[model samples]
Target: MPSMKNSSFYPSYFLLVGIPGLEHEHIWISIPFCITYAFALFGNLMVMFVILVSPRLHQPMFIFLSMLAGNDGLLCTSFTPKILSVFWFNDRAISFTGCLLQMFFIHSFTSIESGFLLSMAYDRYIAIYNPLRYSSIITSRLILRLVIVFLVRAVVLVGPCLILIKRFPAFKTNIIRHSYCEHMAVVKLADADTHVNSILGLLVAFTILGVDLLLILLSYTMIFNAVFRLPSARLKTFNTCTPHICVFLSFYGMALFSFLSHRYGKKIPPSIHIIFSDIYLLVPPMLNPLIYGIKTSLIREEMGKILWKH
Candidate 1:
């Protein structure tokens, strides 16, 4: 809430958060994220294009893939520019309002990603458990409804949380250590008492991470129970889910690592903590579609067809 007029930290403060004494080393971070952003953009765009152009890939799985692609696209775009700005421009300071908006959109797409993943898991469960009715169950109408539900639920859930974050008057240090506007990062900068924000964030995390993981686990449990009863054909069916399983493991495992490190691993170097935290945030969105594309034969073949046709 307090402003230091014409200090050496002034320019960087507007772009990145500056601690009173420490110099921000931002240029070192910019190069890698730029490269990662290019790859993420290309990979997600290709996934979207393949789904859009290939009628053969119009099933529930691909439909969900499209949704994931959309989420990844928004996630990368939403966070990357400000992250790059913090590094490239030597600016970590965000306006109170800009910070709040960034946090809201970040949560929106993140919640949507969680919801979509859960939906995908359920689709897998139905397809594996009752192959006889897969076609009838995952109709276009149902897919549309599911997408609407994810969008609505994400907005409803994050809306109030954002409102809570916005009400806090800027009080303490403005320097956010990490690149983008994370809920925790923004809340940490608050000069006011943040007990309420912390509790609300914990609730949101539980709702999104805990609930989504619970459903995914249940879905897998049912799937495995059903999977064991089937013959060799079931193994082939399970193979289709290998990439998704990989994504889930990478995404959630890294998330757990980051959360634990941030909350409990105080002994670790801040740089190490920051790197792992960014990995949890950035890697999965960039890699999930690529994994799906490679693992799903239909997507692979369709991508090939599109490439050749183009």
Candidate 2:
């Protein structure tokens, strides 16, 4: 535990330890990581391409789905390349500016994804509860507006956290224990008082993610109530929700586990923390498209057609 107060110069680079206690297993560990990365990239890209070309997918649900796919691709791209390099090539030295850029995009995209999930939940609620007005209520134009708003909110909220990091002109250490440049990981390296940064990070997480999760739950509750009222609609509504519910559980389950482990599991092994951290970021992007492809008949049909045509 050292302070940067006495250091004459700030660090220009930060080193990422791929997995602190499991360096010997990097190659083996990377096999699954690389495979998942490939799957996620290919799957998400296919989702976007299929949705773009298929006129049958020109609805709010599919439109939001395409957005999710695109976001997932970008989100995975932000960290996976660097992570793979760390594992395969031992290229762990990241420039300060580059680290900041990675941190910003990772958190921003995370917030945007949370918001998008909320939007999707809202879409489902409307489709189930207000079928007649669903089209008017959740139009393409409105989706565009919602995307813009989500993006703006993410950038605006995360900008201050980045600024706070920049304000800390010195760091006690340049080596990050985790594989990626996460906000808290970097902030903990700073030599200055990081209370503001920590508080802001928690505030943003609670305000954005907490609120989104609550709203999503509320929407689903309403949808369930409506569905139960009409026994004939129960099966159809459940079918429609299957894929979404799967994606939602997978995305948020890992997220919550990772967050809690990072904050409270100090006695846990470093490798376990690192593994869960990587999984949280990588799994959703990798699995989301696959889940939708298998569970949503429309996407599965489109994928089948593409393969058959080829």
Score residue 165 of candidate 2 by CA lDDT: 88
Model 2 Cα lDDT, one tens digit per residue, 1-310 = 2323345357878889889989989999999999999999999999999999889988889999999999999999999999999999989989889999999899988999898889988988888888889888998789989999999999999999988888897888888889999999889988888999999999999888888888988998988888888668556766878788888888888988988998899999988988998899899999999889989999889878988999
Candidate 1 positional error at 114, Å: 0.9
- Give each model's whole-structure lDDT: 0.77, 0.89
> Which of the numbered candidates is closest to the native, going by highest lDDT?
2
TM-score (all chains, Cα) for each model = 0.90, 0.96
Cα lDDT tens digits, model 1, 57-106, are 87788888888987888887877887776667655567767766777888
Models, CA RMSD each:
3.5, 2.3
Question: Which residue ranges in model 2 land beyond 4 Å of their true spot?
Answer: 1-8
